[model samples]
Target chain A: MVKGLLDWIDERFKIRDLWNDFADRPIPGGSSWFYVLGASLIFIFSLQMVTGILLAMYYAPTPDHAYASVKFIEEVAPFGSFVRGLHHWGASFMMVLVGLHMVRVFVFGAYKKPREIIWVLGVGLIAIVGGFAFTGYLLPWDQKAYWATVVGTNVAGTVPVVGGVLLRIVRGGTELGAFSLSRFFAIHTYILPWSLALLAGLHVFLLERAGAGGIWNAADRVPYKAEPLFPNQLFKDTVFIGMVFIALASMAVLFPAPLEPQADPTDSTYNPRPEWYFYFVFQMLKIFEGKLELLGTVILPNLGVAALLLIPFIDRSPERDPAKRKLMMAAGALFVATVIGLTIAGARAPIVNAPAVTSPSVLAGRAIYARNGCSACHGIFGKGGKIGPELTHVAARRPDAAWHLKHFRNPQAIVPGSIMPKLDLSDRELQELTDYMLSLK
Target chain B: MSDQDVSRRNFMIRTIIGIGAFIGAAISVPLAGFGILPVLRKKEPDWTDAGTAGDLMTDEPQERRFFQTVKNGWQEERVERTVWLVKKADGGITAFSPNCPHLGCGYRWFSQERQFKCPCHASLFAIDGKVISGPAPRALDTLSAKIESGKVLVKFEIFQVGTTKKAAA
Candidate 1:
């Protein structure tokens, strides 16, 4: 019965033939466990897409609700925590797999001839995935996400002429808020995924067209022997994927993803650090501070990406053996080593302390005041526009918390004709600001 | 010899299948339960102390803050919560949740104006917690409170923030 149904479909769709063409393609003799990296990357990418979609169903993309929504998913949703853990670990896994695959391609000189386009597509995929990671990091609206984004956007603002514009565009305003969250959610969920899916499809198509570039059989001075892809290579890839799944599941069950404190834009004591993958770049900023910031933030990184993309054009050698490609091998190795070294150094670096202040609520209140744009009119500690009365000693002058609260809710209610705009704050936020004002005395 | 060997082979095959099924169930059942249990769980509210009745002045609203441990699915965190305590002239004590009656933004006490003001949408409440003006659809949501040996104990509950009526969350 199944055979009859399959035959009926195959008559119009050529399903069997399509399967044969895709699964039964020829693989080279030198293919080994090392060849599984690319397939593993594809597998991990699909996992990320599935888990990310599941998460998006519950994720709220507004500054006011983002943190609470993520908390809901982590604590209240069924298996939501596990699914989140999978997505988190899967991102790191994809990075590792893509890196390993790129290293394998470069070392084998697979990017040598008719395969230049594939290499270019692969580089583009890396950038897109990196972008996916960066944008997704802020969706939870936690302390880490907020502070890291602040530092990241500030780095963009250091670019020579268009720095200020780039910073505004990335942040969606002068600071991170509702607009920034929505913008990141759109890019992370919609834009980058579609772009990555298209680029990945092209990459696979070009890869199949060129065939696997086997390790050079030195004695014959030619490529290794060819083998069918079906049972041999595919079987090995399946095993590798299963092993990766087991590892991922175990990690998800054990550690799970962390939910840090809610993002506080007003808190200044937070020490912002980028994810492990971007630690090398973060470390570069430290080494090249002040006048040399542009060199680390813009010039060097772009040059590295350009060099990676143009490798096929630069090295036109026919040799596929690493021994024959001395300069390329050395440069690739050095680049990998430096990145690893810098990442380790960044991780080991001591945390730099900001000026310590007692009372977190007071600090939070100060942040709320700034976020609500109160400083635009009122002067505090002698800095700000003097249009409104200085708030430095308002607590002592009034000594009534209720009056301040009523005035904040309705400026005209307390002051009769007060023009101070009503500032909307949550119950917790109101108390925070009240506490801060009371402390001003 | 042939009969004996056939029986032995059948026994071995059955044992392998039995073990495989056991392991599969061991891994899958708990995982499935973990994925489904959160949907069935109910949230319980906690009662907390706001402050002593003596700490509040007559006809004045005082702000009190405390931390409540919140447990959701797999996460447990201590979240800061706040309330407004009013010591009425009649010697009766009343506690109000800080959320404004209109859009859920916090309403503050304006001592000079002797009223509660919500900055977000200009919602106003009197010192005794009645809606005075602006977009509020009702009076401030008051929590259940009791005085025990000079300490004011209040049953803290969350209500739907933007609702016209006070609905427990």
Candidate 2:
């Protein structure tokens, strides 16, 4: 009777006993640092989702109430500011981690052999992040969101024949009105997040199946060994998340987000620039717009994406060691260097002031503003929206022609952290818009 | 080559195979659960119409209520909401939400701006619900309205909106 009872207890406890076991895969020291990047990215993404849901609990998407709701979250909700801060910092964290993850993948040759799909997924991830940045920029519904979106849409119009259609689709019409915002909000808050979650799951599952590439594969001499994954490696993941949280907390404390004044649609001389990540591409496009504008703006980026996906195919050799793969090393370095240079160029690009113009140009300017969807971001009178600024008095604010030109040339210089992308405008358009903006009393 | 050694080798092979099976089964247990999630998830959204045809008066914004019974896997939920149906001067109809675009607050028709306005954040919309001022991210959604026997009908849904283009409606 005693033996039978003991056997029954053991049978019932079998599965519970099984899960308590763990395994380890030998993760190298260099990989240890690199591992933190992916883990940190996941941590931040999870945090963003959680906080976003909390915000959504109280968020209203209507233009009339979005700002007040945001303000209410910041002021009245319990720990609301903290939650918002987490989301804000989390986005920045995602950007940084993605870059680092890309670098790590490149250097380690992790994207090679049986991993082209993984690399392509990484590119897809960036595209989603870009979408995220674009959509989130408008959430504050302040000057930065409004003007930046205007410049962004205008730039989209520069893509040639299909450009007009693409611009219209992106803006949800010729003007940046209700449709555009709705489309963007749907894409940002609902669509992209679900896709990302699905893809991420796939990516992780594939990585696990492929197993850790192991430090020895890169070391040439030391053969790879499987190490227990739990206490040995996963513990470090826990620690990494903790560190990331602390860093995010520090950033939150140091720099609380700012709320810009309302966007003024009548402010034709608006300044707009994208976030730092896109600055390099923006700068590259400006130089190339002189020659192969479409190639530089669209085709080239698409090619880069293709190349990233094809890395595993091109890198047929099994040499995981960066030291052994000279060609890949040089290529990776060049790519990184080029992007960095372009970023610097984008940062250093000069802002030109708008040329001085007279009366008719000013009237033409108003027409341009009305037609171009500038109202979506910039406010008209003291009324309207607040993505850019109230342009009803912009002329009094910055009366100089040169100042207007500079504002149009590079918005980020005057207002740092603005999401307003620079536009490819004709000199005539720029001057007229400036004149009109300055004419606003 | 010895008889005892041959037996030992055979016994050792079987023991190893049994242990390997145990580990494989152990790993598959978690994967099985993961695999089941997509199947168990809520049903994907379908195109749904919100309200009736002529019930929406032209030149005025009317709040029409909609109800839907959605089947998500084995469970079902009956959802209801009030969405805006606007009939313009051109005799065209656009359906949208009475919910504010900013934080989802209810919006009212402001005769002054000739628009729908959210009082919470001072958001003002044009007569057509185009955002004239305030923090709304998008124009009010056009609810799919249908008329049956001159009565207006609306379909409401419990939807998840995030970074993608999916709507649960």
Candidate 3:
């Protein structure tokens, strides 16, 4: 039945010839496992496409419904959490694969001579992937997503000349609102995907025309023995894809994607951190602080990308072996090392102006406040159960520290019908807790 | 390659195939559930107040248009719905769904013929909602309706088309 059906369709479409042209290829060197990275990336991209479409069915691109819709998908829809989990983990996987693929190509000297166009297309693909990550991050419209976009757009605003216009264009207004969510949704779902697809198609077409880079050390003069890519390379590719699938699926099942609290534009104390892949750049901003911030925010990153795109032409040596290209190889390794080191540092970096720097009394008061469960009703720094009035600006309401101390001692005496219980705390503890309360504002 | 090397490669391929199948199961199970579970789940009937019961008290079927707040996905949309209400000889109100049973076309109440005529498929339903003289497989579907405080309320629903049974679509 399948053969007859294939014959019927193949007669009209000539799918056999197309399949042969695509699959029947020869590798200059017998297929190696290193060639599997690109295939794994393509597979992950396909997975992302499917999961993204599924998510879009449930997602609403507006300020009012975006967070609630995501919540509904996660908590109500069947298999919604798992599908979202796959997409989230799949994004991280794609980033890692893209990096690995680029590194593999660079180390193999595959971007030299006839394959320069492929490298250029590869660079464009990388930028599109980065665009995907940035836009996809904000679709949840949560605290982390919103703040990260604010920081991201602000970073763009640091660019000279057209920074203001660029920021306004990106945000769709002076502040992130309905337009920002809708714009991000459109870009993430429509614009970036189409661009990536077009670029990737051209990249693969160029790759096929140029063929696999093969063994770099294979003497150009000699005719090296070649093996067909069918069972040899394809087997390796399938195995690698399968392995990646297992790891991604495991991660998705174990730790599904998280949805933080809804975005609160009024909260200034909330520290926003970019996704892990962006840690290097985030750390760089910290390194080049204050007046020199423009260097890290704009110049260095652009320069790095320009350098990468120009590498093949800049290093004009015909030698493909790493041993022969010592200086270039060293520079590449150093760059990779620096990025890794900075990422590690960023992960461990302490929060600026954290409560640790506060006076001893304030620190003791924070501990006392926690012990007394004061946060149950009164919220500070945007963290609390919030059953009562928020205490984020409590100091502004009651400037006198003595009033707080008195309120702690006797609730009904200070304010009639006050629901606050009289805490049996020591005088020192009361003083400390009051100090912590005053420090909030 | 040596015989041992071939065997090792085969074993590796088998292991990879096992993992591939595991991954397939993981994805397909969730995907199947995601697609099917929502469809299988029953939707609660949402009743909307169409108009005043006294206004619709007549022998002829009255077409009442009302806005219904419907929760579709995460959005709450106000959709315009129409229902044909008929005041019987006993004075009890019967609300008929506006669509033809054959293919879900909007049917009109023709007072001259005293029947609901569908323009799309030419299906005709009598004032009593029975198939008068057309290709309609069953009678016109009735909406769950009640009169409360001089207001006519209707619980709107869509039924499966081209079917003998009045199953909810």
* Model 3 alpha-carbon miss at residue A133, Å: 0.5
lDDT of 3 by residue, A78-178 (tens): 99888899999888898889988988888888999999989988988999999999999999999999999998887877677887778889988768999
Residue A311 in model 2: lDDT: 83
Cα lDDT of candidate 2 equals 0.68
What is the full ranking by TM-score, best candidate first?
3, 1, 2
Superposed Cα deviation of residue B155, candidate 2 (Å): 37
> Which candidate model has the greater DockQ, 1 or 3?
3
| Cα lDDT of model 2 by residue, B74-104, tens digit | 2356666667777767765666656665666
Q: How well docked is model 2, in DockQ terms? A: 0.02
Q: Return the lDDT, model 1, position A244.
A: 84
Pick the lDDT winner. Answer: 3
Write down the worst ten-residue block by lDDT for model 3 chain A. A350-359
Q: What does fnat come to for each candidate?
A: 0.12, 0.00, 0.52
Interface RMSD of every predicted model, in angstroms: 7.4, 15.2, 2.8
RMSD of each: 18.0, 19.4, 10.2
Off by over 4 Å in 1: A218-224, A356-441, B1-169
Candidate 2 wrong stretches, greater than 4 Å: A1-31, A216-224, A350-441, B1-169
What TM-scores do the predictions have?
A: 0.63, 0.57, 0.78
Answer with 2 or 3, whichever has the higher DockQ. 3
DockQ leaderboard ranking:
3, 1, 2
